[model samples]
Every structure is written in C-alpha cells, then in structure tokens.
Target: MTIYVLIAVMTLALVLLGSSVRVITQFERGVVFRFGRVRPGTRGPGLALIAPVADRLQKVNMQIITQPVPAQDGITRDNVTVRVDAVLYYRVVDPVRVAVDVQDYGSAVLQVAQASLRSIIGKSELDDLLSNRERLNQGLELMIDNPAVGWGVHIDRVEIKDVALPESMKRSMSRQAEAERERRSRVITADGELQASRKLAEAAEVMAEHPAALQLRLLQTVVEVAAEKNSTLVLPFPVELLRFLERATPPETTTAASTAATAPSESAPPTAPARTNGAVPAGRAVYPAAPDAAAVAHAVAER
Candidate 1:
C-alpha cells in the first residue's frame, strides 16, 4: 500500500510540471495573465514557467506581419469613381500593451487601414491617385499609425497596390495622350518647315548674287537625274540666255516682197498716207510698220 501511494504521488507531480512549462519560440513573446489580470511585463523568448491553476500564458508573434487589405470603392474629389487596394507591413512593438490594450491588434489594424484608404481616396483626385501614390501612401501610413500606436502595433509601411479606373476613363486618357503626341508632331513639323524656308531664302540670296552658282546647281541637278538611268531626261533653259540673245541681235529690215505678202488683201479699204515731218505728203502711200525681227522669231519659236 505504501509503494502504490508513492507511485500515485510521482505521477501527479509529473503532470503538474508538464502543465506549468511553456515553450516560446525565438519569433514569439510570452504574455502572462494572473487571476484574470495581465502581468506587468512580457516574457522574452525561450522557456517560461507559470502556475497551472492561477496563470495563463499566451504567445504573441514578434515578427513582421504582411496584411493585404481588400479593395475599397469610393469617389474621388474630382467626382471620379475608383477602386483601390493596398498592402500593410506592421509588427508588435510592445507585447504587454498589444495583449492588454487591444482585443485583436491584427483585425484592428486591418480595419483602420481600410478606413484610411477610403478617406484618402475621397480626398484625392484621379490624377493624384494614379500618379502621386507615394504621397498618398505616406498619408495613409500616418492615418493607420495614429490608431495603431495606441494598440502597441507599429506600422512599418503602407503601399498602394493597384488603382482601378473605369473603361471610359481609360479610353479618355488614351485619347488625351494621343492628342498630345499629335500636337507635338505638328509643332515639330512646322518648326522644321520654318527652318527649311529660312535656309532656302538664304540660298536664293546667294544664288542671286552669283549667277554662275545657279547654272552650276542646275547642271548638278541634271547630272543627278541622268544617273537614275531613266529613258527620258528633261533640261531647263535659262531665261538669262534668252535675254542675252535678244539684246545681242539687231532688228531686220523688211523686204518689199515680204511686205507685199504681209500686206492686207484687196478687199480691205485703204487708209490715207502717213504724215511726215508733222505734215501729210501727197502721192505717198502708208504701209504698216514692219514687225521686230526678235519678236517675230520669238513668236515663231513659241508656235
């Protein structure tokens, strides 16, 4: 009977020892509640001992937690509808407060993040939401951190994951971008044309000062066109050469036979003789003045 009682006592002690021991991982912290009240300080990693009947040990994770907030739909300040979602990075800074001050710090942080995101969306314009996300992220972190600080949770960072705009808005943005590109193209083309016109005007001045340059340019153009090996080649005749010919050649006298050939037909009425020295001469006939040889040759060449 003595041996049985000793065996029973040993079993009970082993069970109590096992129940009182708690293992805390390196990434976790142990919080104790004694008699329904939290302990003053937290226990660091490793083993912890507590009374089985009078104390409770709760392990709190100390590592950073990544939480993804769901998408929130809201209207922006510019009266544009949008949907935005984000990710949150945070961790517990004070385990004692985290365990006592908040019932569930993770859930609390998530709720605050969602609310803050919606508030930011409502206060920002569509342009800012799409382009100025860094500023919006900082503002969002401050908003979430304000309430999280009280719960002993520190918000490390907040990031805007994605912003969803309507299809119509997307098309409008595409059109705006296209129009901007077209405007730049037109401006550039106009600038190029203006530069070309200025350069051409300068070249014309140079060519006018040196007439030989014009002849040389014409010959160069002909050479380039001839290199193409085409069947036909057209050459330009310079106006200066024609004017030089006309100036060098003298007028020709009209022959009586040619004048008879050019004279009016007999059916035409005859006019009075032309006056000489400001007086009409008797027994003298008036014939039309002969045409200029250069003019007649030019007219014949044109026909």
Candidate 2:
C-alpha cells in the first residue's frame, strides 16, 4: 500500500512539472498572468516556469506582423467619392501592455488602420491621394502609431496600397490632361511662329540693304529647285533688279528715249480743206489776205 501511494504521488508531480514548463521561441515573448491579473514584467525567449494552477503564460510574437487593411469607401474633401486600401507593418514592443491593455492587438491594429485610412481619405483631395501618397502615408503612420503606442504596438510603416476612382472621374481627368497638353502644344507653336516671323523681318531688312544678298538667295533657290530634276524651271524676276538697271542707264540714252516717245510715226497721209457754198469762210484759210481780200485781188487784176 505504501509503494502504490508513492507511485501515485510521483506521477502527479511529473504532470504538474510538465504543465508549468514552457518553451519560448527567439521571436516571441512570454507574458504571465497570476490569479487573472498580469505580472509586473515579461519573460524573455527560452524556458519559462510558472505556477500551473495560479499562473497562465501567453506568448506574444515580437517579430513584425503584416496586416492588410480592407478597402474603405469615403468621400474626399473635394466631394469626390473614392475607395482606398492599405497595408500596415507592426510589432509588439511591450508584451505587458499587449497582453493587459488590448484584447487582440492584431485586430486592434487592423481596425485602427482602417479607421485612419478612411479619416485620411475624407480629409484629403483626390489629387493628394493619387499623387502625394508619401505625405499621406506618413500622416497615416502617425495617426495609427499614436493610438497603438498605448497598446504596446509599434507601427513600423504604413502604406497606401490602391485607390479606386469612379469611371466618370477618370474620364474627366483624362480629358483635362489632354486639354492641358494641347494648350501647351499650341502655346509652344505660337511662340515658335512669333520668333520665326521676327527673324524673317530682320532678314528682310538685311536683304533690302544688300542687293547682292537677294541675288545670291535667288540663285540658291534656283540651285535647290534644279536639284529636284524637274522638267520645268521658273526663275523669279525681282522688281528691285529692274529699278537698279533703270538707275544705272546713261543720261543721253534716257533723253533719247523720251524724245523718241514724243515723236510721231511717218505713215503718209494728206489733209484737204473744205469749201462751203463755193466760197471759203473768212479766217478759215491757212493764209488770209488783209480785211478785204477780194478787193485787193480785183485791184491787182485791173492794174
């Protein structure tokens, strides 16, 4: 009877010892709760011993945990509706607070991250969400870390994963971008044309001062056109060249040209005078006798 009692007592002690012993991994921390109340400090990695009946050991992972936040729908400050999602990286910094402060740190962090994401989306514009994610991410991290710090969770990083825009908003943005690009192209082309016109005006003034330059340009144009091997070649006659030739003519040649222009052609033709009622009208003949032309003729015949 004494031997059987000793064996029963030894078996009970072995079971208690096994239950009290715990193996903690290097990436985990052991938290102990005694009488339903948390202990002062946490246990580090490795073997831990606790009172089997009064003590409970909870292991909190110290390694970084990646939690994906679900997509949240919200309206932006600009009155644009959008859907946004994110990812959070976190880890337990204080095992005591993690075990005592929050019921489930992982779920708590995930909820906090989602709320923060929605709040950020509401406060920011659509442009900021799409183009300024770095600032938004920093803001999100700060927001999550503020509440998480009390729970013994450290926010390693927070990042916005994707933003879904409405189809109408997307089309509007595309048209706006296209219009801006077209406006820029038109402005650039106008500027180029203005510059080219100014350059052409300056070139024209220079060509006017130098007659030989104009000739050279004409000759160059001719050469270029001739190089195309076209059957028809047209040469431009400049009015300036004609003016230059006119100015260079001799004075005698100019006077003779004026005289020749005034002179009549020698085509032969004789004009005859007409007699009315078988008598010439007075003052009508080319050479008329004095006032009494008939009396003077009759006196000469009587003499």
Candidate 3:
C-alpha cells in the first residue's frame, strides 16, 4: 500500500514538471500570461519554467512572413477601373504586444494591408500605378505600418505584384504605342532624306566647280558597270559638248548670184524684159545671171 502511494505522487510530480517547463526555439519567444494577465518582458530561447497551474506560455514566431494580397477592383483617381494585387513582407518585433494587443496579429496585418491597398488604388491614377509602382509601394508600406506598429508588426517591404487592365484599355494602349513607333520611324526617314539631299547638293556644287570631276565620276561609273560583266552597257552624251560644238562652227553666207535670184528686182516690172540672144534689153537695168539649179544643188552639197 505504501509503494502504490509513492508511485502515484511521483507520476503527478513528473506531469507537473513536464507542464511547467517550455522549450522556445531560437526564432521564437514565449509570451507569459499569469492568471489571464500578461506579464512584462517575454521569455527568450531555451527552456522556460513557470507555475504549472497559474501560468500559460504562448509561443510567437519572429520570422518574416510573406503574405499575398488578393486582387482588388476599384476606380482610380482618374476615373479608371482596375484590378491590383500585391505581396507584403513583415515580422514581429515585440512578442508581448503581438500576444496582448491583438487577438490575431497575422489576420489583422492582412486586413490592414488590404484596406491600405484599396485606399491607395482610389487615390492613385492608372498611369502612376503602372509606371511609378515603387513610390506607391512605399506609400502602402507607410499606411499599413501605422496601424500595424501597435500590434508589434513591422513592415519590411511591400511590392505590387500585378495590375490588370480591361480589354478596351489594353487595345487603346497598343494603338498608342504603335502610333508612337510610326511617328518615330517617319521622323527618322525624313531626317535621312534631308541629309541625303544636303550631301547631293554639296556633291553637285563640287562637280560643277571642277568639270574634270564629272569626267572622273563618269569613268568610275563605267568601271563599276564593267566590273559587273554585263553583256550591254549604255553610255550618256553630255549636252555641253553639243552646245560647244554649235558655238565653234561659223555661220554660212549666200553668194551674190544666189542672192540676186532670191531678192525682188527693183528696176523691172513683173514681166520679163525682151531678151536678144539670152541678153537683157539695152534700156533695162543689167543684172547678173542667176545660178542654175544644178549649180545651187552642188553648192548645198559642198556646204
């Protein structure tokens, strides 16, 4: 009967010892509650002892938590509707406040993050959300940290994951991008043409100042064409050469006999004078004999 009583007492002492001793990991802290009231200063790593019946230890993790915020639909400040989502990185700094100040710190942080994200969406434009996400993330972190600091949660960083646009908005942006590219391409082509025109004008001036340069260019063109080994080649004649030849040639003069035949006679009437042996009459004005058709044809052939 004494052995049985001793065994019962030893078993109860072992149970109490097991219940009172708590093990905290290196990344965890023990928040002690004494009779439903939180005690000051949290227990660190290693084994912790407390009164078995009057004390309770809650383990809180100190590791960073990665929480994904769900996509929210809202109208922006510019009156554009969009859907946005994000991710948050945070960790607990004070285990006591995390345990006593909030019923569930994780859930509270999530709720605050969602509310801050929605509020940021309402205050920002679609352009800022797409282009200036870094600024928006800082603002979101600040907003969420204000309420979360009281719960012993510190926001390390916030990142906007995705911003979804409607089909109409997507199409409009695509068209805008295409138009911008086309405008740039046209401007580049126009600039190229302007440069080519200026170079060609300069080349023309150079060739005009040095006539031999034109000849050299023609020779170069001929060489390039010959290098192609083509069966046919077309050569151009310069108009200046033709004008020079025309200027060098002398004008022709008419002979006296031919001129007298072509000019109207001032001394005689329309009727021919009476001739004797192919000679003009004595009183009529004497004129040189007109050249024969054979002689005129010979002169033209000689010319």
Candidate 4:
C-alpha cells in the first residue's frame, strides 16, 4: 500500500510539473508575475518553467491590433450637431505594461477613443472638419495616443471612418456648395464675355487700319449663311469703295472745260448762216438797179 501511495505522489508531481511548463508561440509574448505582482520584464516565446500557484503568466499577442471606436455625437465649435465614427490601429510596444497597467487595455482604448472623438468634434468647426480632415485626424491620433502609450498600446494610426451630419445641415451645405459653384460659373462666363468683347475691339481696330478685314469677315458670314441649304445670303459691300469714290471727284469744272463747251455751239448754226446768205443775195437784186453778175464777179475777183 505504501508503494502504491508513492506511485500516486510521483504521478501527481509529474502532472504539476507538466502543468508548470508553458509553450509560447512566435506571435505571442508572456508577462510573468510573482505573487500577484508583475515582474520587471517579460518572458520568452519558447519553453518557460514557472512554479505553479506562485508564478502567473499572461500571454499577449504581439500582432497589430485594430480597435473600432464607437460613434460619438457632439456639437461642433460652430454649433453643428455631428455624429462621427473612427478607427484606431495600435500594437503593444511593452507587453509588461499591457498586462500590468490596465485592467483591459482594449476596452480602455475604445472608451478613450470615443471620448477623444467627442472632444475633437467639440473643438473643431464644421468647415474645419470638412476641409482640414488630415489635421483633425492627426490631432485625434495625438490626443488619444498620449494616454494609450501608458497602457502599453502604441497608436499607429487613427482614421475617421464617417461623419454623419444632420439632414437639415446637409441640405444647407448642399445649397451652399451649389451656390458657390454657380457663382464661379457666372464669373467664368463673365470673364469669357469680357475676353470676347476685347477681341472684337481689337479686330475693329485692325479693320479700321487695313480696311480689308471687314470684307473678309463679311465674306465669312456669307459662307456661313450659304451652308444652310437654300437660305438667302445677303452680301455686304465694303463702305471703303464709296468713300474712295467720294474722295476722287472734283467740286467744280476747269476753264478748259468751259472753252470746250463753247466750240460745239459755235459750229452748230450752219443752216442759219445759209438762210442769211440767200436772203441777202435776194435783197441785193433790188439794190442791184445799178449792178449785174459780171460786175459782182469782177468785184469778187479784185477783192
């Protein structure tokens, strides 16, 4: 019976020894504690032996952890009611503190992240959140990081997943954006109109200088209208031709022209001259009581 009891005691000791032996994986770290107090440092990923009941070890995974912060509702600095949700990425830089410092680091970080989100939302304006998102995200990571560091959680990144705005506020913002776009559109259209008018003025000056571009423009217009299939095309003649003709004409006729006018009238009375000669000859017959043809012929030959 004593031999059987010795065998049972040996069996119990082997089981206890086996129980004290722990194996840690490569991705895990073990924080050792002695009598309810954590040791100064951590343990290994390989085989480790601990005195049962006196030594306690808590294993922590060293992988990067992702924690989601709950949605937080707060009023912005601009008095806008906003609901914001965020995501946090963290990893345990110090495994000992992770096991010893906080009761539950994950829960603590989540709560702190929610609070930090609220605080940031309260501090930032609505436009600041919309326009300066990177700044806000950095600020959030900074604010949440300082406290999380003590909990053995090193915050790598913080992201604002979504920001929920009130329906009324969203509509107001939409209208504001639309109005801004419209204002820009109107300014651009006005600028285009100004440019076009300036170009027209420049072209007018060119036409005034060359006096030919106007004809080209008119010709182009006629071409444009002619392409419309059977449409009547009204052609515009240049006013420069008429102006040139006006400039070339004289106001009065010269003396040479007046003399040339009198020569034609002088030669036009041949019939009258003949009639006067015949009458005179007839009258001379009456006066010829003392004259004959021989006498007239001798007088003509001597004259």
Candidate 5:
C-alpha cells in the first residue's frame, strides 16, 4: 500500500507539471495573470510555466493579422451616400496590455476600425473616396491606431477594398465623363483648324510673293488628281495665265493706238453729176482727192 501511494503521488506531480508547461511558437507570446491581476512583461517563444490553479496564461499571436472590415454605409461630406469596405493589418505589440487593458483585443480593434472607417467617410467626399484611397487609408490607419495604441495593438496598414455608389450617381458620372471627353475632342478639332488656317495663310503669302509657285501647285494638284485614275477631272483656268497674256499685249496695243491718233484722215470725194437711177452720166468721171503721198510716207516712216 505504501509503494502504490508513492507512485500515485509521483504521477500526480508529473501530470501537474506537464499541464503547467506550455510550448509557445516563435510568432506567439503568453500573457500571464496571477490572482486575477496581469503580470508584467510577456513570456516567450519556447517554454512557459505558470502556477497551477492559481495563475492563467493567455496566448496572443504576434504575427500580423489580416482582418477584413465589412462594408459600411455612410454619407460623405459632400452628402453622397456610399458603401465602403476595407482590409486591416495589425498585430499585438504588447501582450500584457492587450490581455489586461482590453477584454477582447480582436473585437475592440474591429470595432475601432469600423468606427474609424465611418468617421473618415463622413469627413471625405465621394471623389476622394474613389480617387484618393491612399490618403484615406493613411487617415484611417492613424485614426484607428490612436485608439488601439492604448490596448497594445499596432496598426500595420489599412486599405480600402471597395466603394459602391448609387446607380443614379454612377450614371451621372458617366454622362459627366462623356461630356468632358466631347469637350476635349471639340477643343482639339478647333485647335487643328486654327493651325491649318495659319499654315494656309502663310502658304498664301508665299504663293503671292512667288507667282510661279501657283502654277507649280496647280500642276501638282492635277497630277495628284490624275493618280486616282478618275474618268472626269475639271481643270480650272489659272488667273496667272490671264495676267501673263494681258502683260504681253499691252506694249503693242499702246503703240498701235498712238500711231492711229497721229495719222491724218483722207480727203472727201467730190460729188458726181446727178444721174437718174441705174443711168450713167456719159462724161469723164470725177474722182475723190487723195491725201499727199509725201505726208503719208513721212507718217509711215515715223511709225
């Protein structure tokens, strides 16, 4: 009986020791509480021992925790209603505080994250939520981290995952975007027209200074049109050709006009004797007096 009692006692002690010893992973920390009060600091990666029945050990993971915040509905500063969801990355920094300061750190962090998200949404506009996520994320991290710091939680990062707007708002945005694109297209087209007009004005100045360029341009246009193998081509008469013709004839015309104005007129003929219709007066026929041959010859020689 004495031998059996000794063996039982030894077995009970071994079992209690085994129960008190804990193997903590590298990514975890143990928070020890003695007599309902949290002990200082934290227990580490390998083995942790606690007093049986008089102490408690709570294992807190030190690894980064990825918690997805559910979609939250809120009105923005611009009075736009939207739903926003996010992802939170955090970890327990101080296990003693995490275990002692907060009843449930995970739940508290989640609540803080949700509240921070809603507050940020209320402070920002819809445009910022959609286009300025980086800023919003930083703000959210700060907001949540400030409250969570007291509970020994460190916010690694916060990211907005999705934002949903109303159907009408989406349609309105689509129309606005379309209008903006149309305005840009019209501006570009007008700019092109303005540039083309300036170039054409420059070309006109160049062509006016050099008339031969007009002829060459005309010929080039004809060639280009002909290359299309069209059956009918309407060729326009160049005004330059008319100008050339007028310049070529002016000198000769001026000389002829001057000569005609200086020449003397021929003398009038003497009237023949009155005669009956179809009857000839039988006598020597009187003739008209002609201009002097010497005067006519002098005028011709001067011309």
Candidate 6:
C-alpha cells in the first residue's frame, strides 16, 4: 500500500511539472509572471520553467507587424475637408513593458497613430498633404513613435495611402495648371519677339556702316522672293539713259557713199528671248537703258 501511494504521488508531480514547462517558438518570447510579479526578462525560444499555480506565461511575438489605419476625414489648415488614410509598421521591443505598462499595445499604437495623423493634417494645407506625402508620413511616425515608447512599441514606418479631394477642387486645379502653361507660352513668345527686334536693329546698324551691303541685301531679298515661285519678281534700277536727238534732215547731210561709211552694218536684228512659262509667273521684264545684244542672243538660245 505504501509503494502504490508513493507511485501515485510521483506521477502527479511529473504531470504538474510537464504542464508548467513551456517551449517557446523561434519567433516568440515568453514573458513570465511569478506570483503576480514579472520575471527579470523574457524566456528563451527552446524551454522555460514556471512555478505551477504561481507563475503564468504570456507569449509575445518578436516579429514585425503591419497595421492598417482607416481613412480619417478632417479639415486642413486651409479649411478644406479631406479624407486621409495611412498604414503603420510596429514591433514589440520589450515584452515586459508591453505586458505591464499597457493593457493592449497593439490597440494603443493604432490609436496613437490615428491621433497623430489628425494632428498633422490640422497643421498642413490641403495642397501640402496632397503633394508632399512623404513629409507627412515621416511627421506621423515621429509623433506616434514618441508616444508609443511607453507602451513598448517601436514604430518602424508610416505610410499615407490615399487622399480624396472634391470634384470642384480638382476642376479648379486643372484650370489653374492650364492657365500657368498659357502664361509661360506667352512669355516665351514675347522673348522671341524681343530677340528678333534686337537682331534687326543690329543688322540695320551694320548695313548703315556699308552702303554696298544694303544693295547686296536687296538683291538677296529679291532672290529669296523668287525662290518662293512667286507670280512676279521685282527688279529695281536707278541709272539714266542718254541718247542722241534725231533730225529729219540727216538724209540730205551726206552722199550715199559717205552715209554708208559712217553708218554701222547690221547683218540681222537680234530676237528677244522667250521666257519659259511655268505654273507661277517667274517675273515681269524691266528694261535697262540699253540691253546687250550679245546677252539677248545668248538668252534666246538658252531659253
């Protein structure tokens, strides 16, 4: 009877020992409380012993956690109402503080993040929040991280997900952007005009220094106009024509032989060149004081 009683007592003690010992996972740490007081530190991932009925173990994951915050509608500094949402990355650094200092660390971090977002939005303009999101996220993380230290949570990062704007504001922004583009285009065109006028003034000063350059420029202009296949090309001349006055008495002044000797011989009268007609008229012919007979003959042959 004594051996049987001793065997029963030993079996009961072994069962209690097995039940009090816990094996922590690789990614987890055990926070042990002995008689309502937390242990010195976290227990290892392999094996941990706790006093039966007096010690309790709470498992705390050491891995990083991602928590998404819902959209928050708040008024900006510019008095514009907008919806804003963000995500937060947090991790538990100290399990003892998390168990003793806070009731729920995860909920505490989330609530702190939500309040930080609103505080940031209240100080920023709608445009700044919409355009400069990275700045806002950093500010949110800094603000939340400071408050979350007491709760044993470390804020890794904060991310602004979306910002919803009113339709009327969107239309206004588009119109403003279009107007800015138009203003820039007008400024560019005005600059070009100013540059062109300055160049023309400089050219005139240069031409005044050399009168012959003016004549050459006029010829260049004529050539350029002709290149466009214009209906007419203008040719300007400013030379005088001096010819001898004719009298009817010239027939009686000399004998036939003398007249023949004085008069020049003419084999034939040269014909004028016929201009080649194209789709557009090349130009009208303006006569000089005297046309070179050889030139006329050559032109006729070439034409």
Q: Which candidate number maximizes TM-score?
A: 3
Backbone clash tally (model 5)? 0
Candidate 4 residue 62 Cα shift, in angstroms, is 2.3
Per-candidate TM-score against the hidden true structure: 0.78, 0.75, 0.79, 0.73, 0.78, 0.67
> Residue 182, candidate 4: how far off, in angstroms?
1.3
User: Model 4: residues >4 Å from true position, as ranges?
Assistant: 1-10, 230-303
- Number of the predicted model whose lDDT against the real structure is largest: 1
Ranking by lDDT: 1, 3, 2, 5, 4, 6
Question: Tens digits of per-residue lDDT for model 4 on 14-86?
Answer: 9999879999999898988889988777777899888877898889989999988889999999899999999
In model 1, where is the ten-residue run with the lowest total lDDT?
231-240
lDDT of each: 0.89, 0.88, 0.89, 0.83, 0.88, 0.83
Error of model 3, residue 37, in angstroms: 1.4
RMSD of 2: 16.1
- State the lDDT of candidate 6 residue by residue for 38-135, as single tens digits: 98989979988888899999999889999999899889999988889999998989888888999988888888888988889899998888789888
For model 1, how does the per-residue alpha-carbon lDDT over 47-130 read when each residue is reduced to its tens digit? 899998899998999899999999999999999999999999999999988988899999999999999999999999999999
Clashes of each: 0, 0, 0, 0, 0, 0
Candidate 5 residue-wise lDDT at 16: 92
Q: In model 1, which regions exceed 4 Å deviation?
A: 228-303
| Candidate 3 to truth, TM | 0.79
Q: How close is candidate 2 to the true structure, as a TM-score?
A: 0.75
